[model samples]
Target: MISLPEASLLALFLETLFYGVFFTCYWLTLGILLKKYGIQRDLLLPVATLLLCIATAHLIIDFVRALEAFVLNVDTIGADAYYSNLASPLGLAKTALYVTQPTVADSVLVWRCYVLNNRSLLVGIPGCIVLLANGAIGYYIVWCLSRTVAGTSIYTTIPGLITTFYILTMLISIVCTTHDDQDMTALISWRIWRSRRSISGGSADLLPVMIVIVEGGAIYATSVLALLLAFLTGSNGEYPAMDIGPPVVGIVFCLIILQVHFCVGNNPQPHSPSKSFTNLFGEQGEQNVGYGIEQMIEETDRSV
Candidate 1:
């Protein structure tokens, strides 16, 4: 009914709580697997550290908004319209209003022109692009890894499931965008349109690849743009303080992500009934599998 009291902060809290649980589950399972294998054991801590920091930042944003609703009695500070407009590629003039930092002026300006100012993920269009890119890349890599390790595409029964889920998730995520059928169309871009189109049986793979391109590029692009801004604002060839927070967190994330990417390997797309680090790395993999499992479970719990 869209009648929830703004002061309730129900949706806000729920989203935070929901993602928290999801994030935790993902890491804990991953940790459990890692400890069991003992592969790159040292990385466990770094990966956890980076995730926690990012989670912290995310918490800060969510809690502040929640507090505002509870204390100031403001749901959005009347900034939704402004933010929506700023999220558009067409509203260049309006978007420029947010960048008041002189130190970040030039870098932010470039980003505005090339990346940030456009209708990227924050706007929902480009984020799809990134997701598709990941899907395609993830699929192909999985296929290749299967052949390398298992000598067949049917390496394991699970990779197919993972692949299926991956594709399905990508499709569902994009299709779920409700930018159309209401006042939201003005804010919608090709991604939202494509999402609707997919649900309506209008597209080939449900969501278009272009959506992934924009999405994956959006955040990293934002970070890159921010880093560039730091330099323009006289970073003295050093990472700026404001920028460090994200990069410190992001780089660690990237490393762990890459490591995991290779860890799972593209092997036969999946493995056998005994699929795991043990099969992948042998007795050595089994030695620390428990530790890896714990890290994964703990991470999942914390995220929850």
Candidate 2:
């Protein structure tokens, strides 16, 4: 008969299977986006590639950990040695995979915030600091986890950092949605909420992408919030959540990029107007009065 530890290991294997499916979907969608966008080379490619590598590394680490638990521990070493082995360096390395996954995922969100804000240093500084602090705290926790086995104190503190990261990410998304929407000239300007209604007529082409971005961020942020709650409550039931959270993070990021690619391909909206034309048009196109009204009209009709 399987014991509790064995059962938990089996459940973790199942969760790993689910994560594999999500990872596969990420690659497929990434390929489709690259093809659809006609992106020969872009920054996002490297970011996606890096994430893929990290996720693959995580999977490898998980597999090794499972082997240690099931084969080495259960089949050969006996329960006493098995439990002892769990506190070994390899065991802590396995646990470290979880930390690495979320950190990289959060960094990706931070990167998105930077890009969305027109690469403004001022805009991303806070997020960068928070991200670094998260990494530092996580590293400390991992070091402590490796060295000791008696206490829940370090583990409990992790949720706070995770919560802060998620809250900051949500704030970044909200700020970009509300303020940076105006900064993006390629797409029609519309706030995240009430987007479909606000962007009427031909301008509505960009609405779907906007919705995807907002919803994708919300999905990730909500998952983080749930994970934080699970950790804070100090329940063993948090296992399932802990197992699946990383994959959910990957899914949301991939979904956002895929949806944006699909919408942009279908929409084929115009590029941002040239700087001189923008200055002439202003917000109301009434600032300059009569200078480039005809050109602005031409650009608007052709683009929007």
Candidate 3:
């Protein structure tokens, strides 16, 4: 029978394998996005290129560490020795990779937020600070672990801080995408009102893109929340979460970018004068109706 630690190692190996599969999918999707959208010339191209390199190197390190601790060393060394190996300098290097991947992913999100917000310093500066702080704390935790001979429990604040970082990122993303040239909630309300008043069956091409943005943020937020909860519980369950979370974060970001490329990049035509308002709302319907009165009434009702 497989012991708990052995099972944990097996789970880590499986998670690493799954991460490899996700990384492959990321590359394929990236290729398709670049081919179709010509995003290779965009700013995201270099960032994504760097991220891919890091992911490849990180995965290679992961497999090597797993092999050293679980397979290659298992026969010669005992279980304690196996776990102890994780505190060695090489093992510290492996643990530090978890921080590296997330930091890059967070940087991507921050850059996207900056771009989406028209490079607003108000948004970008705080994000940069938070990211830097998170990286510092993560490295400190890893450095502390590296000096120890046995694996030790990390600070609870670490996970909480990570959760905060992810929340901030999600908020920035939601604001940027939803407010990109228009408000998503307002657009959806307009659509529902228009549907109630008219019989149009056509939908906007950008609607799916917006929906994907929201869904992507939700997926990433959920994953981060799960990891935070796992850490909060102080159970070994956080191990699997740590194993799978980084790649999943990368995959989510790539998927969002790809969806945007497919939907927005393919249809680069400028909207007609009459359809400009419709494009802003990202829905297909008559644009003659005024939302000003309705918005005022809602605001007035809320105040009352």
Candidate 4:
């Protein structure tokens, strides 16, 4: 018989796992869009924002359905519970945050697309329309989230590794000259290419640790390798965050499918990103040991 707290913890764990898979798919989609279609950076940001907002909404709804299990007693769940839960000033604030998420994403898209991207006649005239509109809504949600729901499941939402990375990056960004996707890529490329004969030079030992940190150690080495594919291409910097979940999950799922073959050691291995260099630049590309650490690319010639 599992205790109630144990059950709750189990639920939380499952929720986290499911969300991890969820995020992974989005990340893979985003990666494909970026790689092949060359999604506009400004466009991509709002789409990310929209996906997050939608995910947040789904979370809130599920929380409502699960109130009895996670919050007040199971039998006590009722109209009173529903009404009372939102009665707290804090609860109300959180509720506001939840409601406004979609609006914020929608409004931002409108502003960026219809206003800036379109070079709307409504924008350049400088009426402060978009500024006032965005500020009002954005700040409203910030206040709501800040006030609501007693901080909620933030710990589960962002894994320790990613949360820590964001915190450190934000702190450094406050003062240091910021490096964008390009600058980081150049550094990574030079390190990996060390004349191309060897594809193992830029091993930030800490990076492989991130795989275990954000994701549990259940996945196979193949999945981990696929998760590392972008890094092999020196394009890891192009991604904003881990971007591992979906690909890792896919890798794991495939591995599960290929288990018999793997056990027998008879199946062909899946394509390796190590081959991407070879794919892009051909045979000579594989031999690209041209430079080492000092070659930070100020800009990626290709679009991000």
Highest lDDT against the true fold, candidate: 3
Report every candidate's CA lDDT. Answer: 0.32, 0.47, 0.50, 0.32
Clashes of each: 37, 0, 0, 9
TM-score of 4: 0.30
Model 1: per-residue lDDT, tens digit, 170-257?
2322332111010111122333334334434563331223332233233233444544443344432212222222222233223323
Off by over 4 Å in 1: 1-8, 19-39, 42-45, 73-304
Q: After superposition, how far is residue 295 of candidate 1 from its true place, in Å?
A: 21
Point to the candidate with the largest TM-score: 3
Each candidate structure's TM-score, on Cα atoms with residue i matched to residue i, is 0.28, 0.64, 0.65, 0.30
Question: Which has the higher lDDT value, candidate number 2 or candidate number 3?
Answer: 3
lDDT digits (tens) for residues 1-110 of candidate 2: 34435544654775577577667757866675465321212434555555556556666665666677667767776543553443567556655666666566556555
Worst 10 residues of 2 by lDDT: 178-187
Off by over 4 Å in 3: 1-7, 33-42, 84-86, 154-210, 213-215, 264-304
Candidate 4: lDDT over CA atoms?
A: 0.32
